[model samples]
Target: MTTTPGAADWRAANLANWDERVPIHTAGSFYDLPAFVAGRNTLRDFELSEVGDVAGKTLLHLQCHIGLDTLSWSRRGATVTGLDFSAVAVKAANGLAAQVDATTARFVTADVYDAVQALGGQRFDIVYTGFGALCWLGDIARWARTAAALVAEGGFLYLAEYHPVADLLGDDGATVENDYFHRDPIVVDAPGTYADASAPMAATVTVEWRHGIGDVVSALTAAGLRIEFLHEHDHSHFRLPAGKGIPQVYSLRAAKTA
Candidate 1:
C-alpha cells in the first residue's frame, strides 16, 4: 500500500509497529536493563567522546526507543528527556529510568517531527537522535528543521548513525541489491528485529525512507546547523561484520550558528 505523502497513515502504522516491539524488547536481552541497573552506561565510547560533557546540560533524545541512552545521560549528570512515538516505548523508558534510579530523566510520547512542539518550544543543550533514525524519516529536510529547532544556542546535535552505504548492502555485507538513494518509502514485512531474529513480534511490518549521507549533511546545513565534524567508522555498535572491515557507521556533530 502506497502511503500518501501528507497522510497520517504512515506515522500511525510505524507507531503501532514500535508499540508491538516494546514487550519483546523488554523481555529480550538486547537492551540489557539489568546491566544498566548494575551501573553500566549504554552510551557508546564513541558518543561519550563526541557528545562531550552532558553534566549540567539539558539533553533531549528524539525517537528514543526505550531510553537506555537517555537515562545514561542522566546518570552522567545531564537532565534528560526521551521522546518516542510509541506509548508502550515511552512507558518502558520510564520504567527503565526508575529501575536505574535516574530521577532526573523523563520520557514522553511524540513523533520525532512533532517533538519540539510537544516539548512546548523547550530546546536543549544537546539534541541527539541517530543510530537507525535517518531511515525512518521520509523527509530529511523536515527532520533537520525539528532537530535544529531543538538545539539551544551554542549547543549542538550529536548524530551517530548506521551509514547509508550499509543500508544498500545485504546481510552478507557483500552484495548491493538495494537502491542507494530513495525518495519514496520502502515497505518491509518481517517478523523479527535486528536485535533478535527469532523473537516473536507483534509488529512485523515497517516502512522506511532512505537518505544518502550527502542528503543528510545538506539538509542539516540548509537548516542552519554547521557541520562541526563528520566521521565514518569501520565498527558498528549493532552490526557483526559479515567480512572484512568496511565503513559501517558514521557520527556527526553539528551546531547552530544562526
Candidate 2:
C-alpha cells in the first residue's frame, strides 16, 4: 500500500525520503561520483553562461545535493557555500569538497527557509538554485523572500529548473495528464530513488508542490528583486519521451537592485 501524508507533513516525509536516498545516490551511476571527483562538472552549460563569471565572488547554492554543482563553481574561481536540508547530503558534499581539494567550499545542513539564520545572516554575491528544486518547495513567495534576503545588494539570484509544463505531460511526454496550475500538495508513493530505481527504499512517500512561471516571477518581484531575464529551453538534463517535445527547462535571473 502507498503511504499518504498530509500537506503540513511534507517536511518530515521528504526528509526521510531524501535521507534514505542519500547513500543510494552517492553510490549510483547517475551522479557518477568517481567521474565527478576526476574533474567532471555537474553544472549545465546554459547555467554557466547565464550566471556568468563567478570568479572572486561569493556564491551560495540552496538545496545543493552532494555538492557536485557547488564544488564545480569553486573550481571556476568562486568562493562557494552549499546548504541542504539533508544532513547526509551535506556530509557527502563536504567529503566531495575534500576529495576535489576545494578549500574554498563549505557545506551546511539547514532547511532553505531557515537559510538566513542558519548561515548567520551571511549574504552572497550570487544566490543560485534550481534543477528540480522549485517542486520541493511549498511556498514560492516565502522561498523568494528568503532567497532575496540572502542576496547581497547589486548581486543576483539565478534559477535553472525543470519547466512546470513538463510536469503536466504524461510519461509519453506529449499527452497532458496533470494540472499545470495545481495548488494542492501532491503525495507521491513510489518504490525507489530516481538515480537507482531498483534500489530498495523504506521511505517512499514524498510530498511536492508545483509553482508556475508567473508565480515564481511574481514572488521574486514582490520580494524586491528585479527580473533580469527568463529563458525557456527544449533541452533538459533528464531525457523526455521521443515524441513531441515541449519546453523542458527554464531559467530566470533576478537582481537585487537595492
Candidate 3:
C-alpha cells in the first residue's frame, strides 16, 4: 500500500525526516566505530573491487551520512568531498574526520539538488552513492541529472544500492507489502529507524519512492551517462526476512561513459 503525493511535497518531507535520522545512524552499532578503527573495510568486497583504484582522484559522495565511507575513500588516496542534507550529519562527519586524522576529506551540508550551484562548477573524477540512498528522492530523473552534472568529462558516477525487488516484500513473509511499480511517494509513519532497531524514536512520517531497475537505468541514460554494469545479488547490508540469506557479495556498480 503506497500513499501517493506530489513530488515537491514528498522531497521536502523526506529531507526533513532524514535530517533527524543522521545522528541516530552515526551512533548506531551497525556502523561500528570500534571495528572501523581496527581497519575493517565497512564497505562490501564487491563495491571495493568494482570501484577500483581511486588514487589521486577527486571523489564526491552524495547523501554521505556521517562520512564514514567518504573518509574511507580518502584513506585510499582520493581527495574526497562529502555532501548531505543534514547540517548535523556534516558536523559529525567533520568531527569524525578530525578524529581519524583524515585531512584530505571535507564535508558540506546541502541538499543534493542545490549542491552543484553551491559548488561553483566544481566536478569530480567519481561521483558515488550507496545503499538506501535513492529512496529519499522523489525524482529519479532529477537525481540522475544531478549526478551526471557533477562528473567531469572523463570521469564516472558509481552507485551500489539495494535491489528494488527486496523492498517490496512484507515482513509477514507471504505478501507484497507495498506497491513495487508505483512512481509516487509512500508515506511511512513509524517509530525508530532502520539503523538502530532498539532506539526509541518520535512518531514521525517519511516519504519514499520505489524506483525499479529500469527506472534507474533509464534515468542515468537520459542524463547522458552510459551504463557500465548492473549486477544483482541475493543479500543486502541488513537482514531481510526468512529465506533471505546473505550473499558473498551484495553490491552493484555502474559507471558513466568516458
Q: List the global CA lDDT of all models.
A: 0.84, 0.90, 0.78
Q: Write the per-residue lDDT of candidate 1 for residues 104-223, one digit (tens) a residue.
A: 899998888898789999989899985888788888999999999999998999999988787777777778878775668887878878777787777676888888889989999999
Question: Which 10 consecutive positions of candidate 1 have the poorest summed lDDT?
Answer: 236-245
TM-score of each: 0.94, 0.95, 0.89
TM-score for predicted model 2 compared with the true structure: 0.95
**Preferred candidate (TM-score higher): 1 or 3:** 1
Better of 1 and 2 by TM-score: 2
> Candidate 3, residue 110: CA error in Å?
1.0
Better structure of 1 and 2 per lDDT: 2
Residue 27 accuracy (lDDT) in model 2: 91
Task: Give me the candidate number with maximum TM-score.
Answer: 2
- Please rank every candidate by lDDT, starting with the best: 2, 1, 3
Candidate with maximal lDDT: 2
